[model samples]
Each structure stands twice: as structure tokens, then as C-alpha cells.
Target: MRIRDTGDLWWKNAVIYCLDVETFMDWDDDGIGDFGGLVQRIDHLADLGVTCLWLMPFYPTADLDDGYDIKDFLGVDPRLGDVSDFVELIRTARDRGIRVIADLVVNHTSDQHPWFKAARRSKDSPYRDFYVWRADEPPPTHDEVMFPDEEQGIWTYDEQAGEWYRHRFYRHQPDLNTANPQVRDAIAKSIGYWMQLGLSGFRVDAVPYFVSGTADDHADGLDDPHDLLRELRGFLGRRRGDAILMGEVNVPYEEQRRYFGVETRTGDEDDVQGPVGQELTLQLDFNAMQYLFLSLARQDVAPLVDTLRARPAIPRDTQWATFLRSHDELTLDRLTDEERQEIFAAFGPEPHMQIFDRGLRRRLPPMLDGDPRRLRNAYSLLFALPGTPVLFYGEEIGMGENLDVPGRLSVRTPMQWTAERNAGFSRAQPRRLVAPPPDGGYAPEHVNVADQRRDPDSMYTFMQMLIRRYRECPELGWGEVEILEQPEPSVLAMRSTWQDASMVTLHNIGPEATTVTLELDDIPADTRLVDLLQNGEQVIGKDGKVEVTLDSYGYRWLRISRPESRRLL
Candidate 1:
């Protein structure tokens, strides 16, 4: 199938950098990252070859649900900066050739929000129905609480109103009643406000929970919620034509299809198809992302390849948002019990496994036993994958997870700017740290950008070279992927092809050296293989066989072309 030229310009050949602005920079020294602080870092992101900046929520929030618990849709959190700060941040990022995609959490609002407060004050309050309210009956059994450790049920009893309210996430973050037309209209207006300020797109949060479970059905699929999304899409399309909308539908592969506008598996009346309403462009491919992590952690490639092959073909103009990790708590919910057991069996022998699973108690690489070689291999696979790659903040510098801090705070450590006090995150004293700063293990003394920028063999430099190669090769960005059939389990190979140009990508995951022999008959006899990483390491002969040795965890991207077709570009 041919790719549609939607003229949706921002995402094409883009490398999106996921930046938690609050944790990115602290220019004002208020012990928090503000928009003005983020504005100052646009040049850094641009220099890194990032085409889009996916900013986490900057909305007015109670800080309980981070910024997801929006109290005011039109305002930015005072702790983060004002609406003016956000506008300036967007403008500054755009000026640096980086498009901005903000988080739009429409599924829920903070309990302290004016609408929620007014709703709870009295049963007859006009805002009472703005959020889901179970009047006389018991709270819906199917409505399960996402945070079972903190809350027992999805509904909390409101003594003042003599009712129970639904909350799919934390109790303080109540799920909006999307079935209500008023709520839908309000959310649309909020989205429009940002669109008017030159926002490129939105990374829609918790899209599957927009609709509650029906009396007979308890699943969080898009059975009845399609209408809500359809309505939202219609309103947003009218306000801002061609604006991208990517939903965070973290569900099984079967159920995820619904978020892409295919309502049901069967072609029945219940099945809705196409864009939920207007043609929504993309949805976060959690399926692929999860499989990728599993493959890396387990040191297995088959499951990942199987999962990738199983995914339904996406529209050519649209693509998956690939990532290694994100700001959310690292829960093993994506893995099945058997798969978890397998991962444990493989990694459990290592001491690092204890720290890795201890729920934010350890730093990143140290938790993985601080092996830079392993880190390099992980990133090689990440960058070579087929999709829009999103680098979690500080990952390029080899930042580790810090679990000693509280509540999903490990991945949210302040950017290690310099090895100065508190890793140069803030001027605040050690005792006043919002979240404990990263220890000296990965501090600026060793892993800072400044130090690595000068070293040719450093991981930072390696990543820069790889990204530069990706930028140089347009085929690498939009080429078709073909996995090579190889006998060795440790050898994973694939080819990216666009028209006459092709690139053979080979990755060695084994600890021992292995020779890969390519049959000359399988490819063009007159073809020449140029090693991309080695700056023109070439292979000359093609006597129906060509052998090359790969180092432990080494990767190669060979640009292949027939001698006669040397001008292939």
C-alpha cells in the first residue's frame, strides 16, 4: 500500500524527545522546572536532532496526580509557570525547528477542580453530573480502581451528596462523564484553546477509560466510548484542521484496534470504524513498545519479531511512537504471569534484578549492574527499530533509575546538567530536594554531555553518530522493513528498503564472536557492502559466499548496492 501524503508535516522523519519540563530545567531556582526554564533548553534539544518535543502535562493541577489531575483546562500550573510561559515555550521550541506536542488529559480532572467541588457540594448542583455519579445503587463493580494499593474501589462514597463517584485512577482524579454532552463540549473548548496558541498536536491520556463499563460489560474497550472520541475529534478538527491526535490506549492488541477507529472485531452493527469521528492520525503502539522492552530484558528476539509481524498495518502517513521507557511507574502489568516468570528466570540470577524490580529503589545502569557495553547494545536496537523513536529524557546520557525516592520519582530525576551539587538540577540544598538527585555514579563528572561530546567512542558520541546517519539516509526513516531469516538465535538481522536503495542491519546479542556468511546468490553478485559504522569498511568479493566476524554485542548497518548501481541514492 502507498503512503498517503496528508501534508501532516511535523512528524515526517522526526525524532521526538520526551521531556518532563518540570524535571528538565530550573532556571528560576524555585526548586521546580518552569516554562521559562524549558524555553532556555530548546537549543539543546535542537542540537540533538530532535524534530518534535512531546512535553508532559503543564496544566493547573493538584500535584496529586502529577499534572494529569487538571483543575483548570485553560491555565498552566503555577508551579510550572503561567499560560504565558507555556505559550513562550511553544514559540521557542518552534523557533528551533522543533514542533511541540502537549499532553491533553481529558479522561479525568482533580477532585479540587471547581467543577468537582461544585458537584460535591450538593446533589442538585448543575455540575453534579459533569463527572460520573452513581446515585442510589452501589458503586459499579466493573469499575475497578487502577491503583488498588491506594484505593479499594473505583467509586468513593460522598457523604455530603449521599452518593458515590467513579474514578478509574486515583480517587482525587475523578473520571469525567464523557457520555454527558456538556463534559464533551467543555473538553473540546479546552483543547481548542491550546490549538489556537500554535500547539502542533496532543498526546491524549488514558483514552480507553473515557467511557465506563456498561451494566453487563466490564471491559475498558471502545464499545461505547467511540461516540465520545468521535465527538471530540469532530470538535477538534473544526477548530484546528490537520492537528494530530495520538491516544494513549494501553490495552491488549485486540482491544487497541478500537482506538484506531475500528470499533469491534466483527463487522456487526456494534463495530465502528475509521477515526472515531474525524480521521485521528495516531495511537501510541504500546503493544510494540512493551514487546521491545521484553525482548531487551529477556535477551530474546523471536517474541519481539513475532509481535511486530502481528501488528495490523498502520496507515502509511501514521506510525507508532516507539520508546524504551517513560515517566510512568514501571509496572510488569504488560507481561503475562508466565512471561514474568521467564524474565525472572533469566535476569533473577543477576543481583541487579533485585534492584530493578524494587519499585524505584535504585539508579538506572547500576541497577543493571552498570555495564556500559550492555547499555550500548540496548540503544543500538532501540535506534534501529522501525518507527518514530522517542528518547526518554537523560537516557542519551545513560541515566539510571533511582528507586530510593518516592512514587514513580526514579525516572523523574532532575537532568544531570553538571557534576556540581545536586547534579546541577537546582540550587536548592540537599535537604530541600523535591526528589533525591541522582547519585555520583551517573553524575556529570562521568556521564555529562559536555564530557561525552568530545570523546569519539563515548555512548553519547555513538548515539550522535547513529542519529546523524539516520538523518543522512532518508530511506532509513520511511523504508519498508524485512526481517532476515537467520539460523542463529543470537543474530538478529533485518533490511530496510526504499525503491532501489537498501540497508542491511545486523545486530549481535551474543557474548562470543560469530561469523555471518551471506550467500552471493541470495543477493546481487556485483553488490558491494559498505559498513556504515566504520566509515566505508568495504567487502569486495562475491563468490556465492561472504563471511564477516561480529564482536560481542556489536551491530552493523551495511549499505548494499551493485557496483553498476553505485549512484543509487
Candidate 2:
């Protein structure tokens, strides 16, 4: 039993909710969501039990790449309101105990950015080196192009600069030269500026591309990239002791661990104080998410269990950020072709439903065929997993995607607050919206917060229940996780224990109802498994064995209890 309720580790038991302001709500009826709209909707998030709000980029942009191609890192887009509106949003969100974090997209900048504009003017410009450039014509690195349909290679020739610049993403956005001390300082300044303006932290975008150097970069750029992360972490700590940097690093588990800060030994190898993570505080768990999909496709728990066991241990303070769908596509690049095919066949059977040849552009509701039981079961499993659960906007209401929207924008449609015109997202005409609200059975008419709020059995209500249960059971986030042994392959039974508190969660992903047997040898002679979801309780007799029946796609959270057990003050 261990107690870990310290001030610096709030993220250990926090629930993160991600949203894009452009599509979240349009308060001014200008066909775009603004900070004013977000401020008005703070109560909705508070009601949903979100501890942290991970906001997508709202900085001044060229309107390319869905705000990722940032033109000014410090200025707010006029259409989305000014600095005053942003400050008001932060103040309002904080009033509800919801900390806000915005996107730190330093990996690249829009070509229209002032720095990029000046850099292209002359070779002697100081900003010229701020971006990666090669004077000589580089060979075709066709494989490096991120968007195969749009880009032919990673290097795009700049006519004004007479040099080829590198862009790992799109041609309109050029990768920054992080190796340059001045650029690093600029990025740090931007981070500090936002923190001073009330941002709790940042969701670092494209962390790998931001830190790693490429062949076209300067000679010194190839040096250890992790050093930048260490510096950023140190800077963040000095500014705000509790501020966190949640990076988007999509790579293999072995490689991804390095982003959390590698363990280094001092002069004495046997020192009592071991090395700890000194870099990013949290990272998106791409590995477990991919395996989760695989497990769902097979309707077996083996894949998820294997991946969970394979996860490398990180420093106690550092944690994983888990999610089902994000603002972007649901990527499955880590999985093999055969496994990827299985998931595609199960969730994304249509060609239009897939993207990047490695991911799905659709949201979860349509993928699961809008089955209420399975939806609740999967979400329950997500909240029960050993990490901080992150929900994309409208996930609580089970929003669907619009296939008519090209590329990743399919999942970036407007939020449906009601069944009114334009889903009540805006007063403007439907055609003038940022993106049309999804159509079909999953449209606002059928699925919306207004309707769900009235129905007790709706997805929105179920998510609220799941979130309440997750927040109540801190063990799920800060406990020792164990994959309990069970006979049914379709069922996954796991236990999380922290201090004197213990909880066991079981989920059945298959279509058929089944019974699962569990042996709790360490339990007391006359103990009971208290159902946290309801009033029912199951007694574990002297034999230390318990049998529980589960309906198809059913789930349960049970707490180990003894007759003498009592709550502590």
C-alpha cells in the first residue's frame, strides 16, 4: 500500500478532454467557434468530470492543416477572439477546476509566418538558418512524404530562397531547425508567454519531428535531441512546478520510452536514489491504443494483455495519456499488415473510411455500428485501463463522422448540442459552417446532448457514470496493475490496488454471454466483491474462489471488501 496524493502529480488521476475550438461551438454565429463560445461551454465539461482541457491550436494560422500551420505562436486568431477572450476562457475554466492546456506546434510554421517570410528573402538573413535548407538539389526521398497523395517528396524547392526546404508534413509548413539556439529560445519564449497568460501546460505537437534532426539540417543539429526536451522540462519546472508537457510521440514502445527521459546513473551504481524521468511528464499511449483495437477486432483479450505486459516501466511521476479517437485519424501504423487488415475489416471496411493507408478517419460510434451495449463496454474498458483516460470532443455523446469531408477532417465536424438547425452549433446557415455536422442515423437529430441528457440510458449518461466511477477509484490511475488470470479468452479481468484500496474490473468483448471464475488467494476468509456500479455484491467464500456471470459485452467494477473494512478519514 502506497500513498501518492502529492501536489506535483495531479495528472496521475486526471481525466483529459481534447477539443478544437473551430468546431467545438460557434457563439458569435460567424461560422467559427471562438473563445467566447468555449467560455460559455465550460460548465458542460465540468459536468462531464474533465480535469484538464487539451485545446487544439487556436493561434493565427494560414487556415491550412486545420490550424497546425501556425503563423504566430503568441497571437490568437482574430476570428477566434483576441487575447482578452482567451484570458477570460482560462479564468472561467479555472473557476470550474478545469485546467487548460493548448497545442505547442513548434515543429513547423506556416510558410506565411514572418520568420519563414524573412528567411526566404535572402541567404544572409539570420532567419534563413531558422529553417532546414539544402543548397544542393537533394535526391528524391519519396518514402519520407507524409501525404502520399499530395506530396511527392520531403524536400520542396523554394524559388525565393533558391534552396530546398524540408517538411515532414505538408509543403505549406516548413520544419523548424531546433538545433539553432535562437529558435529554441524563441520556442521557449512562446511557451513562457502562454503560461503567463494562464495556460497550465502544452500538448506538444509532432514531438519526434520537433526534436530529431534530419540530413538537410545543420551539422550540429544531429547532436542528442533529447537534450532539448531536458532543457524544456527544466524550464517548465522553474516557471511552474506543476506544469506538464504531454508529447505526441507515435513510435514503438522501446523507442517511445526515451521521450519520457532516460534513466542515468551517477558515480555510484548502487545509489539509493535511482534515475527518474526528467523530460516530458506524460505521453500519448499509441502502443496500447493500437493493441486495444486489435483486441476488439478479434473479440479476445490476449492482444491487449500482451501489450500491457510489454509496456516498459516509467518514472513514478510520469504517466501515459490514453485515448480512443483524437482530432486526427485513428492511427494503426504500429501494427503489422495482417493485424491492421483485421482491424480494418472489423471497423473500417470501406475505403473511404480509411486514411494515410495506415489509419481510420471515422469516429468510434459508427465503427462499433452504434451498438449501445458495446459502446458502453468499450468506454468502460478505456476508463478502467491503467492510465489517464482522454476523451475527444463529443465522445461523451457518441458523435459520428462525415465521410463527405475529405481526409482527417471527416472526424473534425461540428459538435451537435441539439437537434435544432445546424445541430445548434451555430445560427448561421448549414453551408456556412466550418464543417457540416455529420449526417445519417448518427446525426444530431438522432444523437445529441439535449436528447441524451433526458434519457438515463443514453451514451452521454453512461459516459458520465464511467467518469464518476473512474474518478472515485483513484487506484485505476495510481495503483499496481495486475492482469488477473481467468478462463474465458473473451473476458479480461484486471486488478488495481493502491494503499488499502483495491478494485477489480472485468470486461467481455465477445457477443455471447459467459461465466468467469477467479481465484483470490490473498483475500480474507469471509470477503465480498462489492459492485461499484450497483447495489449488488458477491461473497467470496472460504475457498477463495468466485464465479461471476457476464452478459454479452458486459462489464463490472468490483471492490475487495471485508466485513471489518472501514473508510478512513
lDDT of 1: 0.70
- Candidate 1's residue-wise lDDT over 1-569, tens digit each? 23334235345457778878788888778778778778877787777778778888888888886678888989888888888888898788878877888888878899989999999998788897787777666744543667655677788888876788888888899888776667777988888888899887788888877855353432443236776676666676787676677777778776766555644446564444332334345666677766655675666677778887877654455556666667775445577867655645543444333332422233335534567766676667766777667777887778766556655666787887776776677787767655666555765566676676677777677777677776655456567888876776677787787666677777776676677765545565556787877755446455755666778877788877666554433
TM-score of 1: 0.88
lDDT of each: 0.70, 0.88
lDDT of 2 by residue, 368-403 (tens): 998988888899999899998999999999999999
Q: Find the candidate with the highest lDDT and give its number.
A: 2
Candidate 1 regions exceeding 4 Å error are 1-9, 136-143, 212-223, 262-280, 344-364, 519-523, 538-546, 562-569
Model 1 residue pairs with clashes: 360-403, 361-403, 361-404, 362-403, 363-401, 364-400, 364-401
User: Which ten residues in a row are the worst by lDDT in model 2?
Assistant: 266-275
- The superposed Cα distance between candidate 2 and the true structure at residue 89, in angstroms, equals 0.6
